[model samples]
Target: MRTLPIFIILLGIITINSCSKDPETDSDDQTKMFTDNDVLEEIRNNTLFFYQGDTATLSAAGNSPHGTFKLLFNQTALDALGADGKLAAGDTFPTGSLVVKDVIRNGNTSFYAAMWKQPSAENANEDWLWYEAFLDGSLLVSIDAKGNGCIGCHRANTNRDFVNSFDLH
Candidate 1:
């Protein structure tokens, strides 16, 4: 009779323990840390230089893309670009470099696209992380170094160190 009570108590304790939340297993909450607002704050605080020269005009034929884009580079990235003022095919941006594109449509800032250099020997082939966020700085997309879409587009610009805006000096 005592054993029956003890077994039931043990089973109840096991159930309670199993139901408790473990931080390590709670990845859903962890992923929320990079939501739109968090990304916006990082961009506002970190980006240093804004490119004011000429804006890249996106074609209206394809997806009716209507935005005048401006480029912004963090200090580290600007320093990497240097005085000669062009990123060459062979030139590699240092790790921690960041470049951002701010898109304006109808005179209102629409969204931002950013690339961050986070190179490691293990992933040297594709070293940049890609991020996109709304004008309010809400994160729309974030792709790590191994991401496909950003790398695929950038691969075409391998001659310009995987950056399409080599002339944005």
Candidate 2:
């Protein structure tokens, strides 16, 4: 009788182990459901912003509406852009590349705009996903589906790989 209980416990352990998902694999899956809170937590924990040179200032009628912004690139994206000292006319950022624009209003960081480069196969039409979020506590806003708004403006800058801050670098 004791042997039977031991066997059942062993079987249960094996089943649980087999059903569990790999954390590393799950983290790398871009399609996974990442909530705004989750992304904000990651950005805060990872210290995603690093570059601190010049602040790109905007006028009242501009996109940021009288805000000063700074562009920050992840190491992977920085390597790709730095390889040529400047991003050429048709250079596409590799998958996992992340660009963040920190927007400042009244000497305080109010919000952020970000772009995440997805695998080309994921979105054949537009591989880059756009996001906006308030720094205080608002949820992330995904604007990729509204291509005509954000994507349309970026499309005009094909030379800089659909980025407006390339000149700032």
Candidate 3:
């Protein structure tokens, strides 16, 4: 089936990108995937929630390289969360959703970990474009490069669409 090849390609991308630290460059072709401006645009115009709006609680990392941080979801992601402010068990995020995690260090964002859901026949499952980078667009983990540990660490069942932020928090 077509799905099988897509899965293999995805696995390879994850494996390769995780092991490689390709700094995001202007010359890098991210047009078909995503760009830094897309992240900024989401932040500027969409809903942002931290600790699900419980400001007193800032979640600490569990086996995450990112220390203290907040999770922000764009309109698509927020809409997906629905009234409960949480995804029901077994429910998956819709296509075109974007969620960004701000890894705060010393009161400022040291880096970002983000997920973007793409259209696929799998109901948006396993279709996320994983990305992580520093403030100046230095890619820590790109959509491509070399073993993407990002997928392994960020399993979908965690009230996430490859989002590890909410479930553990």
Candidate 4:
């Protein structure tokens, strides 16, 4: 009576379970994702400064069609950035200087000039986050700073080793 129907349902469940794939193990069949090692190498060899105290004098093209930027790091500011951008108590950060040869353009005319210290801080990951952009030599717009939340939001994953710098070098 009722026992026969219960047995049939249990049998059907066992059959379905045996036929289904386990999702966790199936990820191995997917292609591996990768970051470009060249970019990391460029950053290491050509970056103006590095955490390990290496230095580079950037070429005009290294700065690119927009301009160049630099960093000056100190422990106070690095601590202020916390594991995230938040500051703890008694935190004081050194202000670093930034010099840019901004490119501005008006129609066929292009010119360049130096801009300095519009914003300044001593933390590389916090203040001088890197980006790539371009313009003529007259009207300079920071394509990088235009989107502040883009980095900060992505950096929400602090557990994944801060991730301010990419891997694959």
Among these predicted structures, which one has the highest TM-score?
3
Q: Which ten residues in a row have the lowest lDDT in candidate 1?
A: 57-66
For 69-152, candidate 3 gives per-residue lDDT tens digits of 777776777777756577656677887677777888878888878777764322122677666788777778765531177666
Which pairs clash in model 3? 14-147, 14-148, 15-146, 15-147, 15-148, 16-146, 16-147, 17-146
What do the candidate models score in CA lDDT, each in turn? 0.63, 0.61, 0.65, 0.33
Off by over 4 Å in 1: 1-39, 52-66, 120-125, 144-146, 167-169
> Per-residue lDDT of 45-69 in model 1, one digit per residue for the tens?
8846754333554422322232466
C-alpha lDDT of residue 16 in model 4: 80
TM-score per candidate, in order? 0.61, 0.61, 0.64, 0.21
* Top model number, lDDT: 3
- RMSD of model 2, in Å? 7.0
lDDT of 4 at 133: 29
Off by over 4 Å in 3: 1-47, 55-57, 120-125, 145-147, 156-160
- Which parts of model 2 are misplaced by more than 4 Å? 1-34, 47-66, 83-85, 120-125, 143-148
RMSD of 3: 14.7
True lDDT of residue 118, candidate 1: 58
lDDT of 4 by residue, 43-85 (tens): 2343232223334322234213332322223343334344533
lDDT of 2 by residue, 1-169 (tens): 7799999999999987876766655645545343445445544655453454334554333343325766677766776775444566677788766777778788667787777665432332366656678986474565434333577667766777777665544
| 1 or 4, greater by TM-score | 1
Q: Ranking under TM-score, best-scoring first?
A: 3, 2, 1, 4
